[model samples]
Target: MSPTQNIVLITGANQGIGYAVAEQLLKHENYFILLGSRNAENGIKAAAKLDPSGKSVEPITIDVTDDASIQQAADQIASKYGHIDVLINNAGNNNEFTHYWKQQESKEEIKLDLAALRQIYREAYDVNLFGAAITTEAFIPLLKKANAKPARIVFVSSHTGSIGLRTDPSSEFYERMSRPSFPAYRSSKTAMNMLTLHYAAMFKEQGWKVNASCPNLTKSAFTRFSDLGRSPAESAVNIVRLANLPENGETGQYLDENGIVAW
Candidate 1:
């Protein structure tokens, strides 16, 4: 590996937006991309598809929700690269949507099942909130060893997490976004935004850039692979741009495809 090459690790990179970002990053001559997937087989497949030459891109098994898996991945990266120039926390769960939709059926008047709701919330938070937090924490020491002037950490957030947009009646996302009804997934993302802020603040003095970004309803597995929204490749444009930002670039802001998104 070149000493000047940028080492970037992206979680949940086996498919969808994470995969798209990995593809886009290959255009850069200086990046050595680590394609992280929960399953080792899937990670190998993705890495092979992305780089058949078996150079520049490599697969890393990382299940954010599992502490041992996350630590093992971190250890491997640290041993090989010493530090990571970029960390993209892209793994998330939205299983609550399926559960909620199913409950809506076979009932005259919809009722909330507190027990089921709590379970849903816990599952969503496990991957979206706690997983991302723990993954970032485990990689912090490796990030601090970066050869790059300022290491970067990006949380893949959503507009549904924006309190300002969800509360404003005139906002385009107020009614269109499904967050208001899906408390589990929505609240977990909101918590992710907070985590982004706290990390950005904690690493600001070191010139690290940490921020959150909303892909704006991209068509992916998360959206049932529907064709209603932008393509994963299109959604990755801004994320790739943010990932390549200079050491002096902005941090701790919620951004979309256009620009700053309301928090």
Candidate 2:
């Protein structure tokens, strides 16, 4: 790897949006991409598939929900590159989709099973909220060592987490398909948005950029690869754009493909 090349690490990159982002970055000669997957075997396969030449991409085992796994990945990166120019917290879970569906089917008449709801919330938050937080904290030191002008941290979030859109009666999200569902996933992303703001504020003085983005219903395994949403490659455009932002680019904001999204 060239000493001047930028190092980027992306979690949950074996497939979906993460995979798409890696593919897009591979076109840039100055980028050394770290494809992070929860399973070591899967990561290796993804790296090989993404880079048959074995020159630009390297697989890294990083299970966002596990601290030990995150630490190990961070240690390995620090040992090799000493710093990371970009960290994409893209791994997320919507485990409570079924429970939320059940709740919506109740038509506001029946109370949800408390135990089941708790389990769903816990699992969703574990990956979407706590996991992202842990991963970001673990990589802060390496990010500070970036050779680039200003290191960046991007969080892959959703519009369902947008309080403005959720509350605005005139908004499509509030008008159509407004049935209560995915509470855990939605709330977790909301928390993540707030977390992004805090991190941006914390690092502003240090010239580190931290921001969150909504991919706008991408068709991937997360959506069972549904045709209703945009393709993963299409959705990755904004994410890759953010990752490649200039040193003076905006931070601490929520954005989508069109432009800046409301908090």
Candidate 3:
């Protein structure tokens, strides 16, 4: 890789938004991507599919839910590349969608399985919130060593995390927003948004731009190929732009395809 080339690591990149973003970034000559996946085989296949010659893309095995896995990946990246220009915390879990919807669909006598709810919430935070936190903490030192000017960190957050939209009476989601609409998934992203700001403030003096991005509703495996959402490539547009932000670009903000999203 050239000195001017940027080394970007994206978690959960084997498919969906992560893969789409990798594809988009690879179109630019200076971007080298590390496709992070929990499965080594899947990662290798995804990387090879992106770049058969293996020039710009490399697959990495990383499970966001596993602290040891995240740490090992960071160490490997540090050993191989010395530093990372960008880290996209894209790995996430929406495992509670069914439970949330099921609970919502229940009539007057809803059986609340507290234990089950707790399990799903724990799973959601494990991958969606805590995993990203752990991974970012593990890689902070390497990120600071980036050769690229104004190192960046992008949190792949969601609009579902917006309390304003959820609470606004006129909002389309308002009717179903009262409760149990994937609260675990939504709250984790909310926490992630706050996390983004904290990292942004902490690293501002260090020339690191950190921001949260909402890809909107993207139809991929994550959504069970829901027809209501846009394609993975379409949802990837804003994320690609965020990843390419300049030194003077906006930070500590939440963005979508068009512009800034309301907090």
Candidate 4:
């Protein structure tokens, strides 16, 4: 790897917005991406497709839910590159419970299966919130070794998680507060926002750029592969933009395609 090349690690990069982010970042010759995925075969296949000559991207197996896997991946990166310029925590979970409290069903006073609801909450929190926190913890040493002045850390979050917008009557997502939907998934991301803030504050003195990015209804597996939403490529625009923040770029801000998402 070139000494000047910036190393970027993007988790859950085998498909969806994460894959698109890798694709977009590859446009810049200065970037060297670690395409992180839980499945080694998937990661290898993705890296091969993204960097056929095996020059820019490396596939690494990293299961955010597994502490050992996270630690192993971090150790590997620390050994290979000594530092990481960017860490994009894109791996997440949104399960059956997320869609259980359907808008139509709520009118019938329908109820979610209590056991399943709790199960999904556990799953969502495990991957979305705890996973990110632990991954960041494992990677702090590598990030501190960064060649760049200020390392960039981005959390792939949802604007629907914003309490500020959820409370505003005029806001597009205000209705979400009335209708019970995605409680497990949304709350996990809401907690992730706080996690982002705390990390930002902790690293503020070192000028680390720790922020959240909302893809905003992107067409990906996360959205059940919706056709109406924007493509993963379009959704990745702001995330890659955040991942590539400059030395003096803004920090602790929640950003989306339009910029400056409400807390």
Candidate 5:
């Protein structure tokens, strides 16, 4: 690693917007990309393919649902780099990509299998929301070890998690949506946004950049039947932009593709 090399760890980076963020960040000569995936083989394969030049990408196994895995990864990074420049909590779950509307009526009228819902919620919340929080706790020591200033931590969230947008009748996504009763995914991300705020407040006392980002409704497998709008490459822009910001960047704010979202 160069003296000025910056290490960036991105979770759930085997595919989708996570992969795109890794790909885009590699253009910078100073970045050492840590591709975090539950599958070690997939992470290695993605690292090899995305960073064929081999100087940028480094694959690391990280199953966010597993506390042991998170601790192991954090320990390795802290031992190797002494500090992490950026941490992108990009991993999320969407209820096995089930079409909630097709399965049931409204969130209130739906009669989902309690066991199934709990199972999905356990994995999704453990990984999507709590995973970020645990990772932040484990890595804060390394972040504070910086020689000069504090580092950046980004939570890759979605607009579907936004309370303001979800409740707004006049908004563009009022009736055409199908987000019925599946509180696991949406609620997990809502918790993620709050987790972002909590971390941001903690880091603000130490002068670090920690914020949440709703990457918008990007074209991905997560969208299910929705029209493909923005590519993962495009969606990665908001996050990487946040990741690469200078020390003066915003913190504790929820941002979409355009600007801040009302909490």
Candidate 6:
């Protein structure tokens, strides 16, 4: 694919790995980067930094949790860009991580506050899982409009979501996790993987490419504790690499910086 032939949209592009990806993509001549953020202020600020003259980097308001917001953003993108070459679903949240774990412990790991769990699930699933699904559904039409190559969708994911890595006895992740039922965070990512596969299978059958990627344990403000993790800029390398894959590249698998992660 030509460097200028793609228009890339990255959700949660205000900071962290998303922002880093924006920074890197801006350096590539002819690639238009849409910086998606919940906050307009942060979005504009990030866009300005990526494109000093505000020509290439376009700041767009998008809250993955809010359907109305997502629709509005989709409408705008459809009208302005006509086609989206690539989409990176990077928006996510973990606000209810601590409480859900505490309640699960109180229930002898058997029960939880259904209301609270639903609320937490709504936020996490909406952003990490459902948001990506909606974005894909909304923009798929525009993607097909692109005459260059099959539209690509890259789901930015985590190793925590890997059931294989979580259950492995010798894996570092299995040893480090403290919560027994911390499924809210981990499961949301797992759901993301499944969604990636669902799209991958469908796209593959239709001869299109869609994939998921794990940045590993990247050090960022999002996590309360992080050791042996790379900086946001460091982690962004793999995400960018996967996003820019050739049309015929791999899809429907979980990957990290080095290569594929088992299941």
Which model scores highest in TM-score?
Answer: 1
Stretches > 4 Å off in candidate 3: 100-112, 170-180
Measured with C-alpha atoms, the lDDT of residue 129 in candidate 3 is 91
Candidate 3 residue-wise lDDT, 1-263, digit = tens: 66678999999999999999999999954898999999999999999999998989999999999988998999999898899999999998988766545666787655658897798889999998999899999989998899888899999999889887677878665665555567789999999999999999999998788999998788988877878999989888888888888999989999888788777
- All candidates' lDDT scores? 0.88, 0.88, 0.88, 0.89, 0.81, 0.79
* Residue pairs that clash (backbone atoms under 3 angstroms), model 1: none
Candidates 4 and 6 compared by TM-score, better number: 4
- In candidate 1, stretches whose alpha carbon ends up further than 4 angstroms from where it belongs are 100-113
RMSD of 6: 3.8
Tens digit of lDDT per residue, candidate 4, span 1-263? 67888999999999999999999999954899999999999999999999998888999999999999999999999888899999999998878533653644566755558886688788999999999999999999999998877798999999878888887888776786546667778889999999999999999999999999988887787766767688999989999988888878989999897879788
Kindly give the stretch of ten consecutive residues in candidate 6 with the minimal lDDT sum.
95-104
- The model with the greater TM-score, 4 or 5, is 4
Clashing pairs in 2: none
Worst 10 residues of 1 by lDDT: 103-112
Q: Which pairs of residues collide in model 5?
A: 107-181
For model 2, the run of ten residues with the poorest summed lDDT: 95-104
For all candidates, the clash counts are 0, 0, 0, 0, 1, 0
Q: What is the TM-score of each candidate against the true structure?
A: 0.94, 0.93, 0.93, 0.93, 0.89, 0.87
Displacement of residue 189 (Cα, Å) in model 3 is 0.6
- In model 1, the number of clashes is 0
- For candidate 6, lDDT tens digit of each residue in 73-152? 98998887777888899987876656644555685664547886688777777788888889888878877776546667
> Across residues 103-185, which tens digit of lDDT does each residue of candidate 5 receive?
55455655558787678788778888888888878777877875435588899987777778777787776553335745677
